[model samples]
Each structure stands twice: as structure tokens, then as C-alpha cells.
Target: MIIDRIDRALDMTSAIVAGIDGGQYADASLCAGWTVRDELNHLVGGMRIFTARLTGTDPGGEHHDDWLGDEPANAFHLAAEADRAAWRRPDALEGVIELGFGAVPAPAAAAIHHTEVLVHGIDLALVTGQEKLVDDQECERLLGEMRAMDFSMFRNPGMFGPETAVADDAPGHRRLLAFLGRAV
Candidate 1:
């Protein structure tokens, strides 16, 4: 089930990138200072980091802030494929991996990446004026995962934003965005 979720997430990310035109890459994303391209970079780099951990290899980099500049589509597909391949390994879904922040069990790591891909996919869609690209089902599933996890570590500066108020009756996606500090 988790692997299927990851596959779906990657497919969504790939489709978003494929649909984006060249000129929109510089638009500001929901992430404070990051552009759409920067968000893509972070997504790809994150997958790279996860792949490294799962494969027990060095990432050969101190940071993952670089962007594709003019080649985002191809770069993203290649990186995404590598990431998916690594995670598809028979043993990749078991045991624990060090995530720089700490050691997390594979399931928790999958959940983290699943949330990242879906949320950032929304960010990319919103910034590009392609909000229809956001998947409602993914958002709902992510909302459930977020609500079930302890939010203690999510309040940090670069992580989740301060909790925003949402109406009790708001839609699942809106509530999820609110919880993540994105005004909805």
C-alpha cells in the first residue's frame, strides 16, 4: 500500500512537471522564498536523499538547494525514476534510515515523503495557476496521515507553519492546508 502511494505521488509530481511551461518556473511558490523551480529542486533532491538512505550510498552533496534552471522536466523525470527504483528494492521498505533530522523507521519515512510530494505538488500547481492539478484524494489521505502523527516536530521554522485557524466544516484539503500553515 505504501509503495503504491509513493508511485502515485511520483506520478503526480511527474505529470505536474510535464504540464508546466518554461516561463512559469520562476513564479513564487507557497514556500516563502522558493520559486516553482526551486520547489521542484527540493522535491527531486529530497527523493535523491531518500534514495541514498535506502540504498546505503553517499549523496555526495552537503545541500539540496540546486535547481534545474532550464531543464527541469527532463531532470525531474530522471531523478524521480532513480528515486522510485531505489525505493522499489525488496529491502528498501523495511528497517530504519537516518534522515539527517534523526533515524526514522521506513514506514515513517515513506509517510514523510508522501506528504511532501503531495503538498509540494499542490504548491507547484497553485503557483502555476493550474490548481486543477491538485488531487483531492491525495489531499484527504495526507490529511489523515497528518492528523494521526504527533505534531511536536512539525512546528519548526522550515517545517510546518504556525497552525492557522480553519472552520470546523472546511473541506479536507483546506483543513490540511490550514494545518500546514498555508492559508486556505
Candidate 2:
């Protein structure tokens, strides 16, 4: 079930990445200090690391060096497909994996990947003037994940910025963004 969610999120992420053009890549993304291209690179790098984790291999080093290859969209597609393939392995969903923070069950790892892809997909859509690309179901799922997580887990620096203040009755997506320290 979580793997299904991860696949859905990856589909959305790939679509968003494919829609970006060269000129728009320089636009500021929702991620602080990151341009649209930088966010996409981060997504690619994350996919590589997660793929290695699922396959029981050391991720070794940052892949940012070649992040923006001749064709970024193609690179994203290949990376995402590899990541998906790794997760689809027979024993992939049956083990614990180190997520840098600690070792977590495979399902939890899938959930984390699902959240990252969905959140960053929205970021990519927003910056590319494709707000219509945002999926309400994906937003709702991520909002639920945020609601179910412990607040303390997000308090540390580099985990999230300080939680932003939002109206009590804000929509789930807006609230989720606020909770992640993003100004919506």
C-alpha cells in the first residue's frame, strides 16, 4: 500500500519535473535558498540515496555533480525508475533501512519517500506556474502524514524551519506547508 503511494507520488514528481523549461529553472522554488533546478537536483539525489537504501548498498557519495546532465528530465526519469525498481524487489518491503537518522522499517521508508516526492512536486509546480498540477488527494495524504508525526521530530535545524503560523481553520495542504515551516 505504501509502495503504491510512493509510485503515485513519483508519477506526480516526474510529471512536474518534465514540465520545467530551461528558462524557468532559475525561478525560486518554495524550498528556501533553492531554485527550481536545485530542488529538482535534490529530488534526484534523494532518489539515488533511497534506491541504495532499499537495495542494501552504501549510497557512497553525493550525485549532485552530475545532477543536471544533458537532459535533466530524462535524468529524472531514469533515477525515478531505478528507485521504483529497487523498491519493487522481492524482499524490498521486508527489511529495515537506515535513513541517516536511524534504522526504520521498509514501509516507513516508503512513507518518507512518498512525502518527499509529493511535497517537492508541489514546490516544482508552484514555481513553474503550474499550480493546477497540484493533486488534492496527494496533498491530503501528506497532510495526514504530517498530522500523525511527532512535533519533536521536526524541531531540529535542517529537519524543518520553525513552524510557520497559520490560521486555525486553514486548509489541510496549507496547514501541512505551515507545519513544515513553509509560508503558504
Give each prediction's root-mean-square deviation over alpha carbons: 2.0, 2.2
Instruction: Report model 2's TM-score to 2 decimal places.
Output: 0.88
- 28-95: candidate 1 lDDT, tens digit per residue: 87888888888888887888788888888876554466635458898788878988898789997799
Instruction: Report every candidate's CA lDDT.
Output: 0.80, 0.80
- Candidate 1 lands at a TM-score of 0.89
Minimum summed lDDT over a 10-residue window in model 2 is located at 59-68
Taking the candidates one at a time, how many backbone clashes does each contain?
0, 0
Model 2 alpha-carbon drift over 4 Å, by segment: 57-60, 166-172
lDDT of 2: 0.80
TM-score of each: 0.89, 0.88
C-alpha positional error of residue 177 in candidate 2 after TM-score superposition, expressed in Å: 1.8
Candidate 1: worst 10 consecutive residues by lDDT? 60-69
Per-residue lDDT for 38-67 in model 2, tens only?
Answer: 888888888888888878676556856556
Q: Evaluated with TM-score, which candidate comes out highest?
A: 1
